[model samples]
Target: MWNLPYVFPMKRVMLMDIKVLIVEDDPMVAEINKKFTEAVKGFLVVGQARNGMEAMAQIPVKQPDLVILDIYMPQCDGMEVLQEIRKQDRPVDIIMITAADDTVTVSKALRQGVVAYITKPFKFERYKAVLEGYRHFKQTIMQKENLGQEEIDGLLPVRMTREERDMPKNIQAQTLQRISQYLLEQAQSFSAEEVAAGVGMSRVTSRRYLEYMAEQGLAERELYYIAVGRPIHRFRLVRQPEK
Candidate 1:
């Protein structure tokens, strides 16, 4: 009889669980993102970062398969982080979860190589779709050396699904919308505390929303120099939403 090795085909080994590192400035948001990622199959949140600096430091340690990064952050920005990641020539993938919907930011991110881009106040369905698509693409690409045109084209759209994803229950979509609308209506730059006061909400809660808005590109946060206290972050609406 002929040798079995020549007759039987070798089975292709599939990728195991995907390790993900979440890089976001807000702890609450990071936690929420962890929960969202856990809901998806074939993914595990391996680490979390509150800022770009920490993310940069943790990448080597955690060695995550992918990163869910935020654009606006203290110490180092997301773009800079993305550039540095590319410099190492690692296969690590990046999916940006930010409020920066501007052309410049989006273009830069694409040029730097991002798997997907999700704006702030996004639904969970969108998040799931992006992750699911990324998972499929990654698994396929790694298993096959050469892909057909159709296979390549299918993976191009990191987010092809139109359905909405669920957001954390604590982060009320309604309140976030109201706060965002109020910011658009603001005549001048205001701190989170000020927005909270105007909207009759707690300062902490307002700050989280403002931070997310700033990350998304709907608002800009300016740092004011202060003599006694730390720098104050005053957020102003950068763009108006469509009617």
Candidate 2:
């Protein structure tokens, strides 16, 4: 016990802290998101923007590794900010945290290459999960010189299989693709009535296809409320037809 060596072994550790920017208009929601971000390991909130304009301004200055963006802000919308970021060819990754559950918004965000899309009224666990998953994904890419097929598969979403791709009875693949293309081209969500008119189908037929698509995970159905009368049922395509 008395004859111990003076030298001691040491191990070196490296950490990569991710810089994050929160672009949300609501103060309360922004604060909550900030707390959630902090709760996750290896993530830091570099800045906060109340609207799209502020987001655009701070993005270049802060140069955050990631952005948690929200839709429906004054001066400009989140989609506009996303487009601007893409136009500038920024390296920043984005995760949408907003109430914009409409298919159009989600589809646009996906097309813009957002890393994650989280709807409003989400729990802490859900928030934590995405941040943690993003962290793992970022680190895996940064640390690896090359990834194997299995590793690459882990990073991407599971593709639909041929057996699982079959359409429901009375739902035709050609018609569904046409409807999906129409939804993709529109700037906003539409009702079944509008979809029928645009796609040359009856309202009942369009509604049936829309609902079927929604059930198959290719489309989203949302209820839009007006001041007068009952809620309007709207549909939007969430993803392109799987090949």
Candidate 3:
């Protein structure tokens, strides 16, 4: 009798440690942020600062590759720090972390060169998604090959197609791609029943595809409550394998 040989997949090696600096007033929040950054394989937290003043002092010495900053703090705020860094011609990338829901602050932060923004009380998965997006963007920029604006935009994180996301172990690529395109065009989260109706598949089949994607971390499932009936589950494409 002939036996099949086992093939092991190779693990991906990160090129370098993506050094990070945390600037948050709350020690607890800073610790949590640090833990999350360390959990990701390629990133490392090099320094932590309680305020903008301390952050300025550490940036030159630590030379972090990225900065996770809080907008409001004693001594100095995030916007002021960003201005100072710009004046000093530092190349460190910044991602703003804020608890405030104010639109004005968000607009200013974007204009001030924050690469991304995250509101407080976010899940680990959401945090991972944004960081992964940023990583991809940076990698694309580093590539010396000529590229178009559309290609550059493609490097940024956007909603995934249903097919491009997670799928069952045994799914036809054509069908998956079609389903993904349909999902991407939809504006809101879809129920399995709705997806089935839209895709011309059975409810069970639609649900299987959605559950597979959710398991793969390519999509997110949210529960909706109704006054008259049981809660309904909705699915949305939120992530995909890094290209």
Candidate 4:
């Protein structure tokens, strides 16, 4: 059976740990951020700092690959720490997690090169998404010494079209695209079970997507019965008429 990596050619590369440091003025917030960072795979919480002063003092010692920072703090603000890090040419990525939602602060952070900015009172799911995104971003860049255009595109964020964004919540664009590509390669109609096997997804999921595609006029659905058992539903890519 062909797996996802096999279907789309990919190189095997060893993944290194993404060391992280949590820098928040509030002790409780810092701890929570630390826990969230550790929840994601391939990330290690190297240290935690309660304020910007302590953060700067420990940054060189910890040498973390990333920092989860807060904007408001005593001693020096997060912005100052960020600027100082950049001024010193420290090789570390920052993700801002704070209540400062003003345009100037946000613009400054972007200028300082923060990979992600999440405002306060954000949901845990959003927090996880940001962390996962950063993980993928780091993994993709580090895997290759030199990246091709495709590799570069993979690193950048994809802007989903209106139709794609409106797709059912359960259906992901990437998976749909994969199934569509696979179906286009087939010469005849195939059952959901066959598609499931080909795409490395559950039969139920494959069936759902196939049904959706059929409804969207992307595929043609048909029913066929063998000698005596129950009839089975099969699907194939919709034939496009020649011009």
Candidate 5:
């Protein structure tokens, strides 16, 4: 009989699980999000709310570590709930889930201290990715002794780069920003021709910007058929976190 050498192992410190509160109007969507939260290893669903009022009632009781909020609700909107949360001086991290992709809406939510924004009709994998990113960010912050401004900024979601903000060779920045803003605002995808009409850009120029967005992984292309001789190609922003 052969004996194996014994080795001592280091004890790992277990971080406390994250408590989550979900505020959503749609029961089915809320359930789906709840399941996803439960599926993540270190996250726990503490409570669920169907509107802003319910959220206000339960959030203080639960004292959740995070809140997943929907913008549109009947009794009260997400902005109202957020304001209430702020008024109470709650420090819970917030992630906004909305079908409205408008730049103005997104800007408002961000200004209100939302940690992340996820558009609706997202893939499960993308949803998982965002959660994982949040988990990592949280862990990093917890483990840090001293953090600089840059280190703090690193915890947030990646935004469009300076080059991405700039227009490609011949395209104007103003034109590109307008088009990008429009796409970010809409629930559905748009063709280059449609976007051109909406933004008052030439179809050819709009196509260039769309193609650039696709190459940068900010947008994805899909085919649309409407009794078509050739299927029209449409573009939609890719909301998944960059790898």
Candidate 6:
């Protein structure tokens, strides 16, 4: 008996890198973002812009799949850039990367249509998660020409009100994400002060995020003491049960 070789038609994968634009007023920050984007697997940093005016000009020339935008800048700000892009009917996705967390600004950005908003002083893991999520989203968008309700929901999740997303006031979602990233990398328990130093934020800010995670069961919190009158609080990531 002779066996014939069967070569099934493989599912084609588009290997082309997703082009991206870095739009931040800070030169050093832009450089860091460039390096970070380059380090990611399927992304290519196509161009960099230092100001909103520059970003406006480069958006056309670069024609990026995505733009990482900073909210504050000279000449024009990120919000302005986003407005201009919409005004011109550009189809590029945007992720707001800024230091501003005021509700007014955040609400404005959400209304104006940002794929995501990340605060400054975020971890590499957080950045990586954003890009990876976008990668999944892009693939879904490409593969599905017409999406059903479930598919649409999977691609662009149903929008929850700001209250739902921000359950506990005084806690920034971005900061919580940074803390989650820290937990992912650390096996040893840590203090809020240590998280503050590690993530370049204040102890109070770090504790807020840590405590919030504890409330959500994303992290475990315990009290410990070392030659002190008062007990110290420590935290570690919680292990989730397998499906």
> Would you estimate the TM-scores of all the predictions?
0.59, 0.61, 0.61, 0.63, 0.61, 0.62
Which of 3 and 5 is the better model by TM-score? Answer: 3
- Lowest summed lDDT over 10 consecutive residues: which window, candidate 5? 1-10
Model 2 stretches with alpha carbons more than 4 Å out? 1-13, 158-243
Candidate 1 lDDT tens digits, 177-243: 7887888676777778788988899999999988866543446667665555566777877543222
Q: Cα lDDT of model 6 overall?
A: 0.78
Tens digits of per-residue lDDT for model 6, 33-136: 99988899999999999999998989889899999999999999999999888888898999999999999998899888898889989998899888877876
lDDT comparing candidate 2 with the true structure: 0.82
Q: How well does candidate 2 score on lDDT at residue 101?
A: 94
Determine which window of 10 residues in candidate 4 has minimal summed lDDT.
2-11
Q: Which residue runs does candidate 1 get wrong by more than 4 Å?
A: 1-12, 157-243
lDDT of 2 by residue, 13-128 (tens): 33478999999999999999999999998999999999999999999999999999998899988999999999999999999998889898888899999989999899999999
Candidate with top lDDT is 2
lDDT tens string, model 5, 34-100?
9988888799999999999999999879999999999999999998898888877898989899998
lDDT values of the candidates? 0.79, 0.82, 0.76, 0.79, 0.78, 0.78
The TM-score between candidate 2 and the true structure equals 0.61
The total number of steric clashes, by the backbone 3 Å criterion, in model 6 comes to 0
The full ranking of all candidates by TM-score, starting with the best, is 4, 6, 3, 5, 2, 1
Backbone clashes in model 4 = 0
